[model samples]
Target: MAVNQESLLKKYISKDQEKQTGQAPRRGPGGGPGGRNRGMNATGKPKAAKASVKRLFSYIGNDKYKLIIVLICLLASTVSSLGGSYLLRPIVNNLVAPDTSVQEKISGLLSGILLMVAIYVVGVLASYGQSRFMLKISQNALQRIREDLFNKLQRLPVSYFDTNSHGELMSRFTNDVDVIGEMMNTTIVQVFSGVISLIGTLALMLYTNVILALVVIISVPLFAKAGGAIANRSRKLYKSQQAALGGVNGYIEETVTGQKVVKVFNHEDISIEEFQVLSDHLQKSQMNAQFFGGIMGPVMGNMSQISYAVTAMIGGILCVLGKFDIGGLTIFTNYSRQFSRPINEISMQMNVIFSALAGAERVFDVMDQEPEAADGENAVKDGVMDGQVTLSDVTFSYVPGKVILNHISCYAKPGQKIAFVGSTGAGKTTITNLINRFYDIDSGQILIGGRDIRDYSRSFLRQNVAMVLQDTHLFTGTVMENIRYGRMDATDEEVKEAAKLASAHTFIKRLKYGYDTMLEGAGANLSQGQRQLINIARAAVSKAPILILDEATSSVDTRTERHIERGMDRLMKERTTFVIAHRLSTVRNANCIMVLEHGEIIERGTHEELLAMKGRYYNLYTGKAELD
Candidate 1:
């Protein structure tokens, strides 16, 4: 079954917020289908391990020369280690032979010890070089992976963000990528070295005594069976643990961000209870995952010990029967132990390998998603939009067979103020979304400047439009810098002028450092009204010919709204504007008012003309009926 990470995270956050605050959770844009699965097979193994590994290596391939050096170092280190152990056979033989004098034996022992010491010194240097080069290679590969992931996110459609939890996406960058890095740094080298050492040890064991080598080889199946079984169980558990961890992380982020809401509704206790459930789930999953993973070491060790004991008893018998020299029996027993050491090492590394593969699969899952549709050939790239927009016979849906806008048609001439007022879920904001090309209409023609909207590059189309949404967001920067964000090249004087037009200049001047004061955490230092004013100011500086204001004035008071309206009147002149508001009075002077009901325009006229018609707009305005 596929894991819906966003739903898992949202379930905890929304459930608590809804029960205590009497507010529904915000759904994904378009109320579309759930997210894709996490790419796990029925046995809990990564569905595309081979593909993921191939792609991961592609990133590492960029540093080919450094990787070559790391490989050479690994070979050098492994050879030195094996060579030093093999030398023990001759050294023991020369030291214990019955014909050797005491003085000769002491000289032979010192010479042999010196040779082994020299080989070990070389091994130490090679090991150090291997670590240094591999670290560089791993870091370079990780940098590229992170860059690609971030770049892909930038090109994704807005709908993607709506459907996926922000915290889960962040985990891909942090925890997932971190595990991949760890494997590259240590596990990759260890596995390669272990394989080489195991092969070399087996060859030496056979050269010393074929009987002993056969005995050691017989234990190989036991190692494989035990390791495979443990790995299979732990793999599934680790995947579960990772999913649970993502959920807990996402919930904590949501709760911290919305702590004020929790306190206001006195839902702290409920929030705690919900958090406990997620936390407990994570703990149990981790406990099981670690238990299975941890046992692979001891299980392999015990089996190796049994194999070693059997090999030693047989080697001792061969020595007593004069079929093997004392020195050969001693070295063969040592080689037998050395043979099992690599097997044990590789078995123990299975957990790291599984973790890294799972992480790589998750990261690749995002990279594999289709990005926003590319702009067509011959798409307009360099022209100012005339601000004329029209939708004809438009049909749209966020999900299949569930139309949100049905056969909607509308027209706005250049420099016109078109206002849409309707009950929530009546497609008020959705119309503006279509105009901005945030989503494509299913079957219809949306024209801008008398040309099909799809004829323009998405970036070029958006460049000419500015939006002020209901929720305000400010980057971590000074107040002046935030306003200037609307237009990157705006001068300081232009920024201040825009702030004045939004009625924000006076309050900005009252701040401790005025316009230069730094704002962080999305402008937490500012009041809601102040933050909304800054957002309006941001739109004012954009100088785009087309503007969208969705609940832009809902956060401000009547007096402040009046000030904003007066300023907006100046800004809106000679520009096309679309307004979505709940307050009927706000659209009174609009050039045209569109009253939508069930995704269809039920009334179209000026505010006064609609009020005179005694229709839906009339009832809504006179308190004769509620908007909902």
Candidate 2:
């Protein structure tokens, strides 16, 4: 089976890589789809490279003073380095010339040696100062960039996370940001120093002998053309490589998180094959990008060597003929070597620069996303709420053109328990989502306390409504800390009281260290019923006026479910409660029950009334038909 899957993966990837499809392999139907389609090449509507680079530099805003100091140091360092080499000419010529007196030659040699040492000392100090300043600037700019990216993520809409994987977002924080840091600290310095060295050497060469300098200048365009072509290819390959890397990480995380299911279903072979395919794809992209990028350095170096040989031959001829002085020839030879060094260095670093830019563009693209829309000025700020909720002709769709909730109207008075019973996909959980304003309805009004829910600030509405989802997510903290997450300011006594109210106190007492016991892996160390009880305890501690229990008792055994139901009964009093459950017995005593099908409410009343109607709800309650 592994062999067969491997063959299939190979076939898929061969075709996939050949076209360079310029896109990642498609994810499964309900998986986290790629969200970076807009600016990256995946969308085919990529933003201009230069514009993104310009914006990335804007993150360095307000550090201009440090940058200015760094620039001054850089200039001083470059000039001193060149001056040391330039001084070699006079030092040698004065000692070698036959017409000079012994005393004059000795004096010239000593003075020139002292100046050379002084020049080197100045260069070392300037270089050190530049490095110190750049370190601070790079770290500070990166710090600000990371802060903005994180802050933007918090404000982004839920729809964003729906489409993007946790791994992809994490890559921005880890891999991409690290690349940017490398560029700022190392690549930027190398390029700046290289360019200054190149230009200064070329100028000196031209002053010493124009003919030799012309030979060096004429060969430069060839290197430029080669470097540009390689850069283009590497840019595409690096972008593809980064995307593939993110895909691989997402797949690994998914498989690891669901490892039990994979083992139960005997899917090990298929999983390995798929992972191999992704890994192979990444290897191929990296190989091509590195191959092309690596060629430029050698090609530039060879070109420089050829130019150096030509200049050496010409300068020797000019010196012998007395057209050029020996000192001038010496400087010209060194300058010729210096002239091509920058081109070679820049060629070698093109790949690093390209990658940093691509990563920065991705980070900036996320920062540029439209954040969750803020509430209007009339939004409630008083933090006061009564437990009244009404859904007036609410309509909504997660996907356009496919309605999930259709003109559903309902009401719940204060202190009422309203239960929603429906087949899966009947918008039961969506209703709770709407009340909390996780999503706004298409054409309807949701009111809390006789006012539009939209009129309340999102934070305020959420504070008033507490929800316990089917899947409980507990952080890596003590039991006490997890319960207190519901109400940050709640005292330990209050948390324990909430736990007691939710019937979790009995279990808490049995556990070692009681409330202080640490939980990990979303409370994986605990039983399913225990986790759900903790979840209920979390909601109990919230002290909200409105509550939502979504299949909260479905995962537990009959005895545990009874305990949970009783705890919920106590929680439901004096609050407007919304319950969604698969078990019919859970909703039997509700003040009202609404049965829904195909996005519309089809039945309403108590359980006895629904049973009397002998409608879809009756069929479900009687077990004649299963919930889809």
Highest lDDT among the candidates is held by which one? 1
TM-score of each: 0.92, 0.92
lDDT of 2 by residue, 414-502 (tens): 78889999898688988888889877789999889999988888889889999998678899999999999999999999999888877
Q: Poorest 10 consecutive residues of model 2 by lDDT? A: 14-23
lDDT tens readout by residue for model 1, 405-437: 888888888778899998888988778788878
- CA error at residue 462 for candidate 2, angstroms: 1.5
TM-score for candidate 2: 0.92
- Please state the error at residue 338 of candidate 2 in Å: 1.9
Best by TM-score: 1
Q: Give per-model CA RMSD.
A: 4.8, 3.7
